[model samples]
Target chain A: MATSAKSTDISKTDFGKSPINARLSAEQKLKLLTDMVRIRCFENESVRQYSAGKMGGFLHVYNGQEAIATGCASLMGDDDHMITAYRNHGHALGVGMNMNECMAELFGKATGCSKGKGGSMHFFAPDKNYWGGHGIVGGQTPLGLGLAYALKYKGVKGAAMCFMGDGAVNQGCLYESLNMASLFNLPVIYIIENNGYSMGTSLERSSAFKSCLAERAAGFNMEWAQCAGTDIYEVRASVQVAMERAHNESRPTMLEIDTYRYYGHSTADAKHNVVGGYREREEIDFYKKNHDPINVFKAKLIAEGVLTEEQFDTLEEGIKAEAAQSAVFADESPYPEVSSITEDVYYEVDRQTEAGRTGKHFFND
Target chain B: MALIEYRDALNQAFDEELARDENVVLMGEEVAQYDGAYKVTKGLWKKWGDKRVMDTPISEAAFIGMGIGASMLGIRPVMELMFWSFATVAWDQIINNAAQVRYMSGGLINCPIVIRGPANGGTNVGATHSHTHENFLANVPGLKVVCPATAYDAKGLMKTAIRDNDPVMFMENTLLYGEKWEVPEEEYLIPLGKADVKREGTDITLIAHGRAALTALRAAEILAAEHNISAEVIDLRSIRPLDEEAILASVRKTHRAVLIEENKPFCGVGAQISSILMEKCFDDLDAPVLRISSIDAPAIYSPELERKQLPRPLDIVAKVLSIC
Candidate 1:
């Protein structure tokens, strides 16, 4: 297990000072960078569209947490299942959800992932093994554990990664889930995205132990670790190591990723309201200009002479165009008809068996 | 056919289902190693092993949510809540997540899970464990609530619930667990949304469920012997997707109807029955539809208070006698 001292040192080190650079090929790095940029651009556009009243209902953007979803999902195979809380547009995009389908869903069009019934919070694509973007606070934790239990029962080699915010740590269901998962040694990774706050309440005020989410895992007798969520390499390494332990020992692990969200809890909250506006414009500018995950990867690629600045710009332009096209498709698509409202509530069928063959045919007079 | 107690019948249902489907699992506080709290799951962990028959921590919400997830992945899970009253702790998962998945997901997912537990009064388990909250689950859609009063119904209905593709809330009676009744030796399934006429008569239709149905039957026998008033008794096997047609038909035939429920009169199953009768069989009524229910008081540990709180056979008889 990685020690707290080493993890702390890793967090303090600058992005370029780390020995571990993303080992992806030039093409893969460019593709991943493009994916991350697409998510950011798409969400920014979504925010603009929401303000213009083009989109309706709760619109949760994945502006700041793109690296966590992209990095973790990139490491996962197609068969692995992913379940998370409502802040899920990034995970959906990372798992290969179509930009058009997702955008259309935001527009409440029939072509959305949930066919317009489940807007931003409840996107589901079973074909991709993306279980859901559950709206309930910590409701998905036990469900993710169950999915992993099912996989083990079926003798399959897949793990379930359950994501929740720092606020959801207080939920009793999560604690019980942790105990059960550890007891059964289920192949599950409980990822706590400790983005400093839960909604608007800071963790320091709410949580008794804010800095060490991993120590709590010891109460359940499970392995644990903490890593810098902003650093892609650290996030990837932590996930990879924890996932290995889970898969090999068939045990659950807790990974607390200390990250930050640039936007408010939801699209509705103002960024300047919380923590006495502790986050200065300089800090936001520093992170965006220097430590932005996409930009960091882009500079690495440029330093390696794998891709030029012009090529990277062209890729960004292409993704923006695709996102815009998706928006248009969603705009034109029709809302689900009313008749489908009662469908799929339950799986039931009426069957007929041959009991009596003797029949009398009577002609109507 | 063999005779078995209601509790043994439920055990048999779990045993048979687990043996038939490898994906079927059972979990609760003491369901596995300690045997079930009522011994309904006794000897299950020995036969199915720990993986299939798990004894979970006393976290109702977590285990129930796990059951929901397992069911979504084609594993038919039967979760025991120890007592139905503890369902309040897991209400968020049961009411919000499990019940809403299929509908909210646009039918993409189905919660094929069953929550089994002992419900209703008469056990002296005190106010906490004795209250009958089957009506609470009955109000939720995308869930089938069944309360079987007989061993035959328990076996058949439990089997049906395990095979069902939607979530089912199976309510058992603590007092009736030891009561024996005849059950079929071969495989059988009683489909949901079907009501059974336990006793047929023409004067009045006594609609009841769970333990109240047995009380209604007892009252029918007494009424026949004493006043010669024939009462038709219907056991509403499944509460949701209620057999409104059969109920309306019975009310139309009898003209006078008496609804008996273990729950309070307000917003109980009896209320829905009364509403349907008023709408469909109002003109056919010989008198106003009478309801026999528990008083609007919480169940008490005291025997006298509990007796006053619950619907008694005498209460049914008096209501029937008045209507007839």
Candidate 2:
């Protein structure tokens, strides 16, 4: 099992020094970089739009933790699934959700993915096998297990990657999910994106763990690993091992990817990132300057002679233009009409079955 | 038609639906090898095997949420909560994930899961175990709540709830589980949001659900025999879709209304129905709408007190005479 090599406590490992798994073609490597750039640029533009009062609701952008979603999604098969907490822009884009629809959703437009019904924290695309951007902390944990349960129930050799933040580590339901996943031997990988902070509170102050968070999986007799989230290669290597365990053995794995986020909890809380803030300015800069996933990967690709600086610049420029184009699309899209407020509440309401047609489902009607 | 206990009627619904659909699965504590706590899922595990009828740990939130997750991917999961009162632990999963998923997804997803268990207070199970959540569940916009008072309604609604393309909260009564009533052996589905007139009269409309509907029916008989007042009993099989037209039609004809429920007096199902009657048929009513809810208190541990705490036939009769 690759669990021995991949499941070490690598929270203190150097981001750029992790052993690289050079199995991807130059095109695939470039695609990973392109996806991350698009996610970063899309969220960057979303913050600007939020500042201009063009968006509504809490906006949790995925700025620094790009490698986790991009790397895990790189290994997803057709039967594989993904679900994450509210900070899910990276995962959504990683699974090939359209930038236009995602951005329009931020603008609360009719053309958005959820038709503007779900605001910033509730993005969903079942067609893409992306379950949702669930708002509740640790609430999606069991759902992730359920998705994997469905896979095993249907005899499909696929895994569900359920992602949550460090703050969710202490939620009772997460522990309940851990026990069920192990007892049922379900094919699920519970991915903990440890960004050090859960909202304004640090992990040290929030969770009471013995060693690291993922080590708690030992209580459930499940496999666990920790990796540097800044290194996409390491992220992919660790998640690949868990996916193999799920596909071959139909087992569950708990992964703690040690990552850092550049912004506050949400764009609404950016004001708390000052010098004397809940976290320090230097801590943020240290990660951005040394461990930025994009920069570290760009340097690695250059060292491998797979990407030239000029080609990299062109790819980035194209990505920037696409992100900007999405903003323009969102700005031009119309808001959903008031009549559509009652539209998607129930499946039968839309299907108009005899039961759905029999009574007044909506009190407003 | 044949006489069967409410539990067996439910068992028949599970048996027929499992035979009818390959995707329908039943999972909960003791549902499999243990034959279910209340035996509602009796013999299902042996019939369908482990893949279909499975046993989960005593974790309500985890299993319930897991069922919701599986239902999203085309599996019709029938999650059995030992008691609807235990749903408090998994309340977020029911109200947030299962209920709101389809709406939040803009119809991109469907959570066709049924979380069913007994939710009554007269069993002397104490305050924590005894709870009627139909009122609480019906308040949510994206959920459908069903309460069956008779074996026929239990069989028919359980079938329809299984086939529904939305999340359904099915509430049963433990005291009514062993009670026998005639139910058709043939396959049939009772549409939700439609009220059943258990007894028809012209003087007053008695609106109730689940066990309270049975109480209202008994009260209707007494009102006819002793008081010489003809009362119509409306059993609200489904709470949310609410059969408001039938309620309005009955109230418009009867001219007086008395709503009864096993839920608490504050914010009960009767509260909403009373407001609906006042707003829609105020001119047609000869008197103000009345409500006979469980005494505004917790479920007592003593059997006698607990029996009186829930809505009784006398409570319905007394409330009816107040308006008559």
Candidate 3:
């Protein structure tokens, strides 16, 4: 067996300086930059549409943590699976969900990814191997192990990435999943996005561990690492190494991405006067000033001669226009048919079988 | 046709399904190496090997949710609970994920998984050990709930539940695992949501499912021979997509109905049937729709209290006579 790497606290490791084993092609790098831009632009527009009453329910924006999702998405092969918690709009865009469909879903249109059924919290693109935008906290943790189990059972090579908040690290099912994933040698990468606060509770208050969120993973005999989530290259490089261990060694790894959430927990939390605030204005300014992922990446691109200052501005405008076009597409899409509400509640039963269906319920009669 | 134990029939179904499809997997506590706590999976582990018939730790929430996830990705998993009552621990996965995944995804994904185990409240087991959660699970929109009373129904429905495209909560009765019934060796399947008229009559409809249906059959014999009343026994094998037509036809014919179940009457499966009958056929009923169910309390551990707590043949007869 490969070295168990028993919780080698990589929280302070400089993964950005780690040798880039699988360098992205020029087109792929450009795609990653555009993907991050799209998520930022789209979510910023969501705030507008939400305030304008175009959307209802919770909208947890992934504004500052764009680099984490963009980096994780880079490691995912077309066949690899990605599952995440409700703050999943960024992950959806990162994993290549249709921009128009995703926006339409936010607008509750018939043409949405979930056919207007699942709003902001639930986005699914199984065709792209994006499992779902699970609403329940830690709801999709075991599912990551399950997908890996199936892949291993079928001798498939791809890994299943399960993303959740730092809050989800305390869930009992996640512990069970970690135990089983390690026991069975399943290819599952447990990614915990540690944005400090879980809902309104700070990390100190919720988690028993005084240190990093990934420290608890040691009990499950699972290899784990932590990275500064603001740097896309760091997240990409670190997760890529973890994914390689999962693929080549058929092992499970827990990655705690030290990140921050710009907005409140949900759209409701965004109203500062109503709910007050979890963090002070100065706390917000600290991350914004030092670790703006988009700007940081832009600076890196300029230094590397990938993008000039003027070109970056033009690219930003292009992304904003793309997001605006998606919003328009969503606006044009119709609401789901009235009868569509009852549909999809169950699988279409085989009518020919006497038992599968019962004369099509009360309405049809 | 061959006479076999209810557990063996379930085992046969598992063996056959595993043989037929490579994707079909059986998982639960002590289901593989230990041959199941009830020995329902006896010797199958040796036949199928570890990969096909596997054992899992006592983490129901994790394994059950894992089964749902695996099923979504082209694997057919039959997850067994040691007791159906233990499902409360993994309630989120069963109700939230298993029941809602198909609906929330706009049918983009389907969970073809079967969760099976005994759900009756007899055999001296206390409250937590025994639970008839048919009403609770069936109430969920996306799931299909099935109960098998006889050895024949057990084999047929267990096979069907395995092959079903949606999530199926296959609730078995602990008391009836050893019951013998003749099952055909030929390939056959009993479709879900279809009620079987175990015995036909015109005087009254004795509605029941699982082991209660078997007891109802015994009560029907007593009513026929001693009381001279021809009772139609309607076994509701499928609970969720209920056989309303079959029920209505029986109620229309009998003009009287008595729901017999070993579950609580407070919003139980019997209560649902009573309401359905009242709504659909108020005029057809010769008397008020009566329900003979377990007493409104936790299942008692004391043998005498437990027996008295659940509906017996006498209770069925008494309820039937009152309706008649």
Candidate 4:
């Protein structure tokens, strides 16, 4: 069942020497590493709890592609926004959402980010400009276009970061979004996290393209760039350029970040029957050895004398403990009351307006 | 009070709401510069300019989805669809994204956007162009559907829909766009989910919404004059937050009931009304609840046949007579 993973040397530049990395304070650089570690620790714990039957529905863990979300979110201004598909735990954590609330959401407790209504796939934090963890494939593309449209409407010099997987590139709505993003000159970046395989379909099988996925951006006459997601510095540099275009010129950009996922598309693909049958273990090991985002960044930080080995271990341990405590918080939190089931369907009902008082809004009620 | 065309009433509502709320914006194909395909958005573009009143590409899914995204951040986007039949292309945005955003986010977000356009038949636009999806939209628990039969209700209901915190699917009729009725110059808001009794009667209850409500009113007059049957006509302006109380109150007094709608017979709005009557007003009913709807088929393309396809005044009269 082993399908050979192709070895493509994407980017081998030493980010320790890059100006973008040098510009960032040592504390800020450590914060980025700490954020990536926090996400990984949380995702690993989610998979553990999910396997142990603590979570329901599909659990789409963002294990390996942590640097893309971490890098892109760092460049976001207060007016900027972020939205992503169901593989959203990484982005939600990167945007500084409470780990306990996010974990409680996965556990379907009242304290969850979405109040147990939107399990893992619908995290939302509008106060922090994290729009959602939308469920549908390619559906979030247009919604992302909208976030940018609204920003422009309000005359904010900010952009919206809309992240999707490689497989989502083929959806018709993405093309529709691309056309409008260019026509209106909205400040939105469409980041495609190309992880070699989508669910079970490899990039070679799922998409038809001339050279790369971002090349399709040429059809709309928008700017595009490709980068390796293993190095956070490279991710920041490539995304900073897109952010500048969005802020200064009010233009959209398509970014293709080459990454890999160690887990299956979701926890349900456990047998690896879907993914393992398509991709080999050697391929997975190759990425883990050569291009693990956390390891790659940690080594660069140490080589630059930003942190000692002891400091790195202590930081990782603290994040791991924080991720573990989130599970305990989720376990202790209560489920929503039965009477609360009918609430939140409408805003008027929640606000108890004059309109909400009269009608038989709920048929069962 | 001033008599205004249905289209003008909607225009006045848009103008007033746009002026009232700076957060409110209008976007859709041909909405700006072109003054709207149906002219429901006429003159707004010249007033609000590019930022507030804008035109979008012919892509329904993208624009509609964009409206939803904008609404989540407190932008009240009153999106026009040119024709409600075109909403099928953006069905995911309407049904899943718009309707379910607030509920799925557990009330963390509110999509207070109004998607307005024509949804009707009898103009011989064929099956594709002629679609009435009020029943489909109302079926979803999170969505609110309203169909205003009169110019007064069009303006009142539309203004309220724009202010409401949930997604509202405002269904309009091309055939009734030019029809004139009294709408006051003063600002007013018609609370949704409240039905208006177009006529009072003692024998039978006739219920309908949108353009079909007018048809039911005509049938009520026919039944009163010709057949000597007093039929109370109930116009259920809001479909989702249904006015079951009004329906029950009218049916209890009349002792017989007849539901009517422009949608197909199977699982139409009329079907829902009949079910409500059966469950809530069974003891008061003197006969089985009957329904008169557009013939159970796709909308006909032929002009002559299309008229026959939709429920006429005589059709409602016949159904009332059968039940009474």
Candidate 5:
């Protein structure tokens, strides 16, 4: 593969010696490692499917940003709500969406999570408390606040985690949502995964102020934090703190996670720019070879003797097999019937019918 | 039955629905302490308290999207757009998210949200404030557009919109707010996609909606007494999922049809009705379908220009009598 020249000039963020000194037990570390690997393998297979033209539509692979989703989702219980931007395959997997359903959705099949209509950008599973994989830049922020309001209204202590990219930080709705969330003390955690670029535009080019996104939280009087998102433990700690603040004090928080995406904005972006359209190929290679979330976790677990080499090998093989089976399931699943289009739009009960009936005679003779 | 103004009937419906359904809530600019721009939400803040009747910031897109999200989470939200013109700002959420969620999810989700506001130009509110968006929303597939012309229909349709499982654009009229009518002193819900026959005759069928429907009825009365043209008048309460059956049946009896609308003639509700008539009742027609509507220019602020911009009762009367 031809490598871009900028890759040589780009400096990687220093991976500080384990941000939190707290050591997880062997079982917990193994479980986290397995989760990360499952997401990595799943998304890798998705990219393969995209390359083969089997997965149509926009394919936004979360190859390099796995740690943020895995770490954050680990803190959420079944009752809490999660909404995120279009780069959402990893988040959907983290929230426990069936692999078969996720793959089928990408394949635009009836058995998919969104019944094949949403494709990749608009997947939603309310039962899982995953509101959506919303495509509109900062549109999901207010929705997250609304979900938190509903939970508070129902006297539930569940928090809503609203995720967006660095590029969406400038949307006017984000400011409005932040104000509302703070004014009402909504239990919401607004996370911005600062991946350095919005499509082909770098954060430096698009954002006037790039260093501290969390600083904007003060304008809304929100609690704020920043962390190295490449480290699962650091990401987990930051999310846990925000979750606690939201649950205990009913205060909203903003967490800025410094992260990156290994793929181009989408599969279609040639990713070539005079000033460097895509990140240096070497930078992607470095992340994929060394700092890959799955590899880092796997290395840590194996070095700590959390699992035998044989067990890790078996886990990888099993995950690969699972991903392959899901592809088959998606391939064989049928497309939604045209007649099914009109269903589920409204809930019509007898009460509405009776009410409509009485009003009928009002206009009748 | 009691006589109440359209505005008061709407207020009563909101108050009663909020009290009856704990899941029902209200949100919009000036809906809380200011009592709504049109005062249709008056006394609701005090009765329902601040939580149920929320006053949102000026971000229409955010609040409307929030309403959609809240509805999906089992809450029935009655969102006021302040004016129907502001709905254009939130079209993305309305058209892409709310309208398509149910079908996109394959029957997994129901967007039971009501977006209600006063539409049409009559109060001389000028171009910016005055707009009739029923035609624009009717083109959307997943939405139900309701334009209620009377106090009875306003209350009934609003209640039904709140209870509906899909997103509904409940369009009211600024001029009709003070108009009084007899309404039953109980809960009622007029089903969507049903038309109401305001008057029955056999000479010509005049079909309209919202304020235009009232104009058509008035025109029907005038044509009956003066021109000796007994025109049947139909109020298409809902624009989407149009009551084509009632319309065709009326046209069959009358043999001639006149469609009236506040929207411009080009791609307006009148055009849709005309197409439906042509397809369903072409063989039974005694004459071609005549449509009365505003010109395609933006509504001018000048009083004379505004008057010329609006489709008047005289326009409906002239079209119906001419066709007869």
Candidate 6:
């Protein structure tokens, strides 16, 4: 959707000349671009496979919000944990999950990240400290608090990043976690990707605050900031500072990354019927042409002489090839054996005791 | 062996388990500074400090969900709910998340959390506060429901539930928390899915768990003294992975069977037990399996009405007489 000519311009300063220049190295800049393009490409492939009926369940695409995930995830290390909502393809890709595994998971194959047990909504990589892509709206909010609590209890130098959408913002679980997070000062960051519409409800209709989502954070005595997600630098600047404060001070921050999802909420919702026509294609195209997060980053990289048009073209082609390989790998992967139907219901990896195996399988085992 | 109250047995389990596993943390409202709403936590908070025995706000959904998350990461968390009825607020987390996460993850992760609190009536807490969730939670797969009627069983099974790798719904009755019983001083662990034959008899088998087990025991004594009926009493410690073998064995010995529970009658635990007996021991039974449960209604504030709401020993005695 093209924005009206009178619409306000947000953060037009080139990242190379702004405060981001001092904080970000050239490698980091290239990494951000690569991550964003990789996610965008992967999601595009998902739409293709889904249309072909290669995947069975719902398909939620995170096409336009690439910068929010790529920029924010770059700040954390191995010890950090992440839990996000179900529109999770981009987040999973950003946190360094194998492209093949993530795609295979959607394919319901054994090689998937969650072993095909969790389709679109549930993606877990415990080894990578990416806890899950939970199906419940705001279910991960409290769980992430517990993860952060564990980090603090162990005196580890790590924080937990919990991501949700504007739709999940109003859940009682979020409010409850916020109050508790403030009470104990747990090292956690609650990121709300305010993509304007949650399913079919717009932010203005959903939020009682009726202004900014971050303003609600003040009630919990939590530190919150609002930053545009269109430019990678803007997201990085906000998330880096938030992560630093949470890790060092044992504080919790509620960060609202203002972004937009160009696609409908899921493949189930038709693009033409986006939020019952509240969002026009012109307004959406306006951002894609003028402030598309990925294109904006690509333009910046070219302007800085980091990459020429020819080099960018080669990068795009390479990324497309990589994304295509993931789809093929997912298609070829095997489904888990039938024995796994009842396995993993409890304590699969950790065996607590063998003192008495009597009736163990019937109950605990 | 030393005589101890049901509350002390649970406290000792918390004390020993916390010492046994550093990852075994205790969290709930008033569980730390306030030493638990019912004082089941007691002085363990002082001994273990805030890290292990921590307190939380009156947020059941958040803390219960936290237990699910932490347990998935090797942290054994025994979360206490102020009351079992409060679990309704966090029902989504318990049924949808904790119970299904392991099955859904296909063995990637499992929630080893124990949601324990008082789930009994007759304290005059009225309708909203009381719940006998044995039948309710037992209905869900991927969850182990433990209802220990005695202090000895409470201590042994509390330790077992804490150490087990699966999510367990530990149901404790506040009415029996103060009852005195001889619990062994030595360390012990009672495996789940096993039931105890509290009394051996000949004429009829009485099946019950938690508070109703005590009621059945009393009813057995009354039946023995008043009538010539030698009633056998079976204490089903864990209702989910139920001791069906023991139940069938008992029913075979005693031709008649009677199931008892404090929950309402419609679609309750007895309804399932009766159906099971009909399938397994239909020919062995001399008469149809009868059940005695609380009247089908919500608990009322009035003492007389509450009394009528729950099952009394006389109800069991009459059922045994009727079957005979």
Q: Candidate 3 or 5, higher lDDT?
A: 3
lDDT of 1 at A165: 88
Q: Specify the highest-DockQ model's number.
A: 2
Which pairs clash inside model 4? none
lDDT of 6 by residue, A206-257 (tens): 7766347776889999998877788888787788777788779999999888
Worst 10 residues of 2 chain A by lDDT: A1-10
lDDT of 6 by residue, B107-189 (tens): 67777788999998888888899877778888777788889999999999999889877889999988888899999989999
- Name the TM-score of candidate 2: 0.97
Superior by lDDT: candidate 4 or candidate 5: 4
Clashing pairs in 5: A273-A277, A346-B165, A347-B165
Best by lDDT: 2
Candidate 5: residue A171 lDDT (0-100): 88
Which regions of candidate 2 are displaced past 4 Å? Answer: A1-20, A270-272
| Docking verdict class for candidate 3 | medium
The sequence of per-residue lDDT tens digits that candidate 1 reaches over residues A87-153 is 8888888888988888888887778887777788887776777878888899999999888888888
Please provide, for model 5 over A1-365, each residue's C-alpha lDDT reduced to its tens digit, 9 standing for 90 to 100. Answer: 12211121222442323343154566766767777777888888888888888878898878778889888887788668898989898888888887899999998888999888788887777788887788888878878887888888777888999999988999887888898889888898999987778898777667765347777898888998877666676678778888888889988999988777777888777872223555577756665676567666666666766777789899999999999899999989998897555444443421245422322211111
Q: Sort by DockQ, best first: what order?
A: 2, 4, 3, 6, 1, 5
Tens-place lDDT digits, model 2, residues A235-276: 988898899999999999999988888888998785446966
Give residue B81's error in model 3 in angstroms: 0.5
Worst 10 residues of 1 chain A by lDDT: A355-364
Docking class of 4: medium
Clashing pairs in 6: A1-A281, A1-A282, A1-A283, A1-A284, A1-A285, A1-A286, A2-A282, A2-A283, A2-A286, A344-B107
lDDT of 3 at A34: 80
**What do the candidate models score in CA lDDT, each in turn?**
0.80, 0.90, 0.85, 0.89, 0.80, 0.84
Off by over 4 Å in 6: A1-8, A12-25, A271-276, A348-365
True contacts kept of each: 0.49, 0.80, 0.53, 0.72, 0.43, 0.50
Off by over 4 Å in 5: A1-25, A272-276, A342-365
